[model samples]
Target: MERLVDYLAPRGPLDWVLKTALFIAAINGLNLTVEFAMNGALSMSLLAHVQTTSMVAFPFTLFALSIIRHQHRLQGQLKHLATTDMLTGLPNRRELLRRLGEERRSFGAFILLDIDHFKRINDRHGHAVGDTCLVRCAAHLSGSVGPGDVVARYGGEEFAVLARTRDPAALEALTTRLCEPFTCTVAVEGLTVPMTLSAGVVRADADLGYAELLRDADAALYHAKDTGRNRAVFAPGRPAA
Candidate 1:
């Protein structure tokens, strides 16, 4: 299911095809042998030819099946790699956007968050520590949001969350946890280092397109950053107080 490109045909039947074809071929060969024997037309030469054909057909069929299985597994692995963030093990931006596009009905909110002064952390602690910080943040965000929500790494120093909840208080609480010092933290060279998050959120609507909502969310996030970091701003309406 990872890819639509079926190497063998109208999709989802490669195994069935292999099994059915082998069964039918076997039945036909047996019928031909029985008929020849009954008619006294069976010859050693004909029997040998049938045996040789069976030997070639069986191995080739098995080989074909093995190749298909290998290719299918490889395709799945490749798809997973392409869509997932390696460090965080979360969906990457592409997957997030894909979901956004596929979702026709409105979800409650689209939230975008950025680490406050992330570059400073990187410059001071080193890239490895910075990476650790991101990993920890990814874990915290995904865990805090729960299974109902989609939390993803939205590229460097940023993460995205999509949820279908109408409660503003819940969104506010989620944002507060994200921005709270030590909530999303990492151990950098034996010292615990905490990071603050700034977020932009937009209420989803049936009227709005995915890109439009995302742009609004991005704007709201910058509003949070501009007014002061470590807060969530609701776009084009008012910053969440």
Candidate 2:
């Protein structure tokens, strides 16, 4: 009984319509079988009845197509939700890695950026202001990237950018361009604070692979922090061809 109820349960208006249409089709088929058994042939009146019954089919077809379209739209929404970070509205780690794998063959650059003194911001002004600061920085970073470039929140206060280019000179110039905009400060929740970030860059290449690229970028980020805040550093290695 429970299984029967589950089978009959309506998912939505379209679902109800589809189920009702199928039931009607089944009933019509059964009636036609009974008539054929009694008369050994379908009379003209019975044929007309079947044709009249099939009039419902046009609407049922439209309903079924609409249900399929709605399902596809729902799947797309689910995919987007799974790939997006809610806090900063940037791509989440999973999405970032997916893009990285897709763009692996194409020589590109990965930049790891962290807000300078992020913990200090959270400690001084509390977590609310820290959240605001993160959102602001993410917005800035997203706006700075070129079309087809990716900016993702890599958990905590760190974000990563995937810039599609191989040339060290071009990547370096793009990195510099990205870094230049954060010179301004953010005003959030009655607190005015500088949005300083230290960035580490690694050029994706055939030799190093992605994990090493991430490690190198992280090391360079720490180097930038150790030397001076609010600067960008590139991992030192064989230049990509």
Candidate 3:
């Protein structure tokens, strides 16, 4: 019974279509059965009625299929929303942490990036402009990073990137690539403004926990923001607090 219920529960558009086809076939078969019982012979009138009913039911079957297809598409979209940042279209903090745990055994680097003086932008131009700046920064980071790299929105004005790589030079190059100047036109009170970012990079080893790597990367990020804006800091031997 459980298996039958599972089979009946809508799996997807194909499942719904198959079920609808079977339902229509069953209805036609029942109609034929009743006709044969009453008339003792197959009649052209009953066959024609069944054909007409099938023709009419075809559109209803397609409509059911369309609804199921739409529902599955919406489910996919909801899953994406749960895992991704709405503003930057990057992975959300939850996903970033999840990936970090998944890749802890492998050789990789964890980078924490934050927009420098982001609050200042909000104070001067307003929150709307600040949001625009974040979105633009996200686009640049997404483009600058490599295919295997994972970029995520860690929080407000903060982002995290994870990449599987062993070479320190390659990691350094990635940090440099992210720090390059990016200009975003943010409309504030009918005027446009620009903003920049600062980042911190830390390589993760087999011995380090994912949380520790995040802490180290965050420290480096704070260091960058403190010394100056729009720079990258690499934490090679820093211990997590």
lDDT digits (tens) for residues 75-157 of candidate 3: 66877989999988899998888878876656488888887778888898778777888888889889988878888899998
Model 3 alpha-carbon drift over 4 Å, by segment:
1-70, 187-194, 236-241
Q: What is the lDDT of residue 235 in candidate 2?
A: 81
Clashes of 3: 0
Quote the positional error of residue 31 for candidate 1 in Å. 12
Tens-place lDDT digits, model 1, residues 135-206? 988877876784478898999999999876767787777767766765344543775776788989888754
Provide the lowest-lDDT 10-residue window in model 3.
Answer: 1-10
- lDDT by residue (151-203, candidate 2, tens digit) is 99998999999988777777877776666645334453555777777788887
User: What's the CA RMSD of model 3 in angstroms?
Assistant: 6.2
- Per-candidate Cα lDDT values, in order, are 0.78, 0.77, 0.77
> Whose lDDT is greatest here?
1
TM-score of each: 0.77, 0.72, 0.69
* Model 2 ranges off by over 4 Å: 1-54, 181-188, 237-241
